[model samples]
Target: MADALPWQQALWQQLASRRQHAHAYLLHGPAGIGKRQLAERLMALLLCQRPTATGACGQCKACQLLAARTHPDHFILEPEEVDKAIRVDQVRELVGFVTQTAQLGGRKVVLLEPAEAMNLNAANALLKSLEEPSGETVLLLVSHQPSRLLPTIKSRCQQQACPLPTRAQSLEWLAGQLPEMAAGEREESLALSAGSPLSALKLHEQGVLAMREQVVEGIKKLHKQQSSPSQLAEGWNGVPLLLLFDWFCDWAHIILRCQMAGEEVDLGAADMHKVLQYLARKSTPSQLLSLQDWLLAHRQKVLGKANLNRVLLLEALLVQWAGLGGKA
Candidate 1:
């Protein structure tokens, strides 16, 4: 059986026992919180004829087929490309799969990862199937944002939420998983992960934990006027903007925590809090929210558009953040 997270084990057990109710389920949670992993585990359990009460029987023929990705009754619907919408045709194709005979002479499973990626037509198409699925076929829609799905879709399936681990739990888990990492590295990785262990592992594997430290240090130098915008931009030239946004969000969270506690914050090597405080003083909560919205919109706008200078854009955003009185 696939290893399930602690929060998921109970739900898996419950689902395993009551296998006769609904044929559709919505597994929703924050990004990188292992929603897909839980969905896959559930799929394996449902398809495993010899499943234990608690989980899948890993030695079964169905489990072997699933492991080899050759389970004839298993279907996965995902975006054709990164950042691309799941087309309506994909949903139509899934409809055909749902109507087919189960190759294992039992249940068929269709899993849609990031179901929110479905565009309007695609979502509506899938909603039709969810409204009335045939036979013992199980439709599992995995989403990071359940709110983005149509109300019709939301009402049709049993919704299950996967939550992030607590800070202490996450720390403990990381220590156990990454014993080779230094203490400081592990702590920073946990923080940068934003309570998601999988995200932490990915960041550690990509060497982004160290890269984030460098970026944080560079930002501090900018605040101290020890580094020029060009220098800062050059230092972070090829870094993923998503990582930059994550670092900034983490910095903001730290600042907010210190403000709430009315305690001195040791920004350590990256004291962007000075600038953050200046902006916070000049802006209300609503304004901060608006700034966040602008950042997200700008991120989408600049993702792959030509004729846009990334370094200049980054510099402009930093200057705008430093000068909150102006437009974001």
Candidate 2:
């Protein structure tokens, strides 16, 4: 298994050193902060026939089996398809697994990621296992948004908060991860990812930087009346809907902040500094607030994977955005 991330070292030690492990642990934190990695490490440690002081002994039989992905007692429950809900049937299957005897004569481990993906029915089904855990079973629940989880679910498990790396730490890690990229580019990625180094690395790999440039240019053109909403929407076809919404939501916030806090407030990304300043000056507080509310509502729809007409949705957003600079 891979080593815990640099920022996860202390959290790892605290968890791995525990003599008494909990029946269920909810590792909650922002996405891309290594919470899943931490849970996996703990799962290995729990299932290992011979665990080291720090973690699992890689040479052990149990460890080898886990590494090979053939560990009988180990279960990973997630949505069958990407961004889909973890259905009630899936949880029932896990419930069945929870009732089984550990084939390896050790502990049974379950890793259910993004626990919020469990719909109401699925979460209720999983609650049965949490309420009355069977055998030496350990459940590791990883969630990016713990607030979305049921209160009963949170009450049952030992909640562990995985922390975001500090800005300096994130930049340092990004430097090593993206060695070929310039310092400014790496910093931009880190900023875009909200100081999550792993997320920054992922965003870099996904070519978000190039997409960001294209988006900024498009927005500038839209503001100039050189590009219409439909044209820019079509141009941004390659960009992820959630990402686009996030950027717009952030821009709306920055524009409002600039209006309220004057030039003293930070304007977020350097690329949008002047643009945000201009919008702040031209747009009234109510216009920006209303636009922000709309962005947030639609952003949630994107997060929920709503069946939306992407072109039309993007056009609507751009139209509202264009109207923000009314009478300018």
Candidate 3:
């Protein structure tokens, strides 16, 4: 297993020093932080035959099993398919596993990521296991949006909040990760990822900078009436739907912010400052607010993996966007 992230040092010490581990721990935080890593580190320590003050002893039989992904006592419950719900059957399997005696005769650890993916039924199924945990079993639930989780689920586990790294820390780490990228470009990536270093690195690897440039140019063309909604929607065929929605949602928010502040507010990045300012001036607060509401609603749908017609959705978004102001 990988080492804990630099930002998680203090958090690791706090968790590792515990004399008695909680039956279940809800590791809550924003996406792209290292909550999963922390949980895994804890899991390793819990199952280690010979644990050090810091963490697991890598040479131990238990650690070897874990490293080889053959640790019978460690269960990972997540959506079998990405961005899909965790079904009740999966949770039922987990419950069964929880009842079984550990094959290694040590602690049993279960890591459930994005715990909010469990729907009402699945969560209810998991709840029984949480309420009546089997001997020496530890459930580590990792969630990006804890608010979306069932109140009963939240109430059962000891919640641990993982915070974002400081701006200086993120920048320093990015420098080491992306040495070839210019400082300004790195900063832009970090800003785009909402200050999440790992996410920023991922966006960079996905060529998001180039994609952003293409999108910004397309929007500019869109405002000039040189490109129609259909055309731009087709043009952004390569961009992820969720990413497109995220950008549009953010732009609407910025425009609303500018209108309310009665001046440009420098939140961080300024990729679309002039365009957003123009929209703020041209569009009424109600128009921007309405657009924001629509964006937010659809963004949730995208996150929920709704069955959507990509072209139709993008066209609808652009049609509303084009009608935001008379012209740009």
Count: clashes, candidate 1: 0
Query: Can you write out model 1's per-residue Cα lDDT over 20-118, one digit (the tens) per residue?
Result: 757899998877667888889889988988978877888988999999999999999998986568899999999999988897898999999888888
For model 3, the superposed segments whose C-alpha errors exceed 4 Å read: 265-269
In model 2, where do residues sit more than 4 Å from their true spots?
none
CA lDDT of each prediction against the hidden true structure: 0.74, 0.88, 0.88
TM-score of 3: 0.95
Collision pairs in model 3: none
Please, what are the lDDT tens digits per residue for candidate 2 over residues 6-71?
Answer: 888888888888898899999999987888888889989999998988899988999999999999
Candidate 3 per-residue lDDT, tens place, 40-159, comes to 899999999998899998899999999999999999999999778899999999999999999999899999998989888999999988988999999999999898899999999999
Worst 10 residues of 3 by lDDT: 265-274
Question: Pairing residues by index, what is the TM-score of model 1?
Answer: 0.82
Q: Tell me which of candidates 1 and 3 scores higher on TM-score.
A: 3
